[model samples]
Target: MKALLVKDNLPDFNGHAALYQMTPAHEGHEFVVASAANVPFSGPETYLFPADADGEIKSFAELDGSYRGGLSHAEALSNAGYTIG
Candidate 1:
């Protein structure tokens, strides 16, 4: 399964917004997106976004069709402190 990691732009959470990991909803994971660090998918920090009617999730796309920021896998990995080069 593929996933995208990006900053949460919503102002309500401000600096508290965890780096979000977005992926298509599947059997075990029902959320379209959640906090990247929430592996077990629990706790208040584990923010979840509802999936589409078809159960597919697209990164950086919203209801009004506004453009949001996106990061490549390499960039996300680096941002998550998993790599350096």
Candidate 2:
């Protein structure tokens, strides 16, 4: 099991925005990133990197889990210096 930590201000599937942080999951956590040209998160999940040249989501693995996929998105989030509320 894993956890997804999405930021505040990013809306959910139903176009509602009610952001909150976790109390720390027993399992490791991943981040939910939002960049330009993107819509608010709209699903039971989320993603990080943008699409690729072929318009497929390839850059995603570059910013996934803490070790396996690459640099940890959780660490990346911490590196940004924002306190998790």
Candidate 3:
């Protein structure tokens, strides 16, 4: 699954973004951001689809632990013609 992980550093007040490809492993999944430059900035960076994207934004609490937030990013990418796991 391909995802865009957005990070923000609050202390530095800088925001970084990156595209990642996630793969399911034996223990868990692996998250690899494509670019080092497009990384997050703050300690608690929120990951969600941009408003313009044709995807839904579900709250963390609403997920109920059934689905991982990273899956949403994969879904968005799949919808946009990217392959996902």
Candidate 4:
């Protein structure tokens, strides 16, 4: 599974129009979460796009259609302060 890995550059907690629309709504909205295990690296912040699908938990790549651009593994690993090979 993959996500649309990007920086948490959202403006405000209640200010970013796009994120605001992401709030929990009806049956269509689902809540899924992913976590890190101190393997590599990434982020001052990042968010799950589309907030997962109804009863769906996906990996970064799985977040495709729901998200746009993405970062490379090397970049992400480097960003998280890892020594990329």
| Model 4 TM | 0.21
Off by over 4 Å in 2: 1-4, 7-69, 83-85
Residue 78 displacement (Å), model 4: 24
Q: Tens digits of per-residue lDDT for model 2 on 43-68?
A: 23223343322223334443332122
lDDT of 3 by residue, 22-59 (tens): 33220132332211122245233224222212222212
Whole-model alpha-carbon lDDT for candidate 1: 0.33
lDDT of 1 by residue, 1-78 (tens): 344444434333312322333333233333333322322333222233334433334443331111124323333333
- Per-residue lDDT of 1-85 in model 4, one digit per residue for the tens? 1222233323333212121112232123333222222223532332233344332333433221222133333333333332222
Which run of 10 residues does model 2 get worst, by summed lDDT?
A: 13-22
lDDT of 1 at 24: 37
Instruction: Report every candidate's CA lDDT.
Output: 0.33, 0.32, 0.29, 0.28
Worst 10 residues of 4 by lDDT: 14-23
Error of 2 at 73 (Å): 0.9
TM-score, model 1 to reference: 0.25
By lDDT rank, best first, the candidates go 1, 2, 3, 4
lDDT, model 2, position 56:
34
Whichever of 1 and 4 has more lDDT, that candidate is 1
After superposition, the stretches of candidate 1 with alpha carbons farther than 4 Å from their true spots are: 18-23, 26-44, 51-85
Candidate 4 RMSD computed on C-alpha atoms after optimal superposition onto the true structure: 12.9
